[model samples]
Target: MYPKILICDDVVYSRTMLKNILDQIGQYIIVEVENGKELISELLKSRETGAEFSYLFLDLELRREDGISLLREVRKMEPLLKIFLSGGISLTDENIKKGIDLGVKGFVSKPYKSKHVKTIFKSV
Candidate 1:
């Protein structure tokens, strides 16, 4: 079966862009969530169903909550989930360090590129 990928971003365009990039790289079951609540709901459902996503591309700043805070909660629930931060602005060193400390696998800068997405997908 194709691996599933979850993308959490407030902006619809950002989610579409990332989905497009992933589509170019390979076939994947891509799911999009607009905020932390939806993200958590999906994660919970995945856990209950035993169909957890293989990857998550989470935006650093959501409309309601920041990704770091959400990451903390996620770690407590799904500690082994592979997460990548997607930031539109350049992330501060401190924030990056915090994310690393929290178990972020890597980062994908805004305006997603197909090449970079391909590399990340292949590596992991």
Candidate 2:
């Protein structure tokens, strides 16, 4: 089966851009959400269906909620979930450290690159 990927970003452009890149890499079951609430909902649904997502591309700066806080909650719900963080200017050193501490797999900044995304896709 194709790997499942969940992308949560408040910005429409960011989510679309990342989805496009992943589409180019290979076959994947990709789901997009605009906020943490939707993301959590998706996760719960996956758990109920017995088809957990293989990866998560989460944004560090969400308009309605804090990404790190959301990440903390996600970790509790799905401790083994492979999470990669994304952000533009708000991707600071401290936040990166916090995410690392919270057990994120890695990070990809804004303006998602196809090559970088491919590498991440392969690693997972």
| Prediction 1 TM-score vs. true | 0.94
RMSD of each: 1.2, 1.1
Q: Write candidate 1's Cα lDDT for 4-116 as tens digits.
A: 99999999999999999988888999999999999999999999999999899989878779788898998888889998988867467887898899888888887888788
The digit string of per-residue lDDT tens for model 2 on 22-99 reads: 888889999999999999999999999998999999998899899999999999999999999999887899998999
Clashing pairs in 1: none
* Top-scoring candidate (TM-score): 2
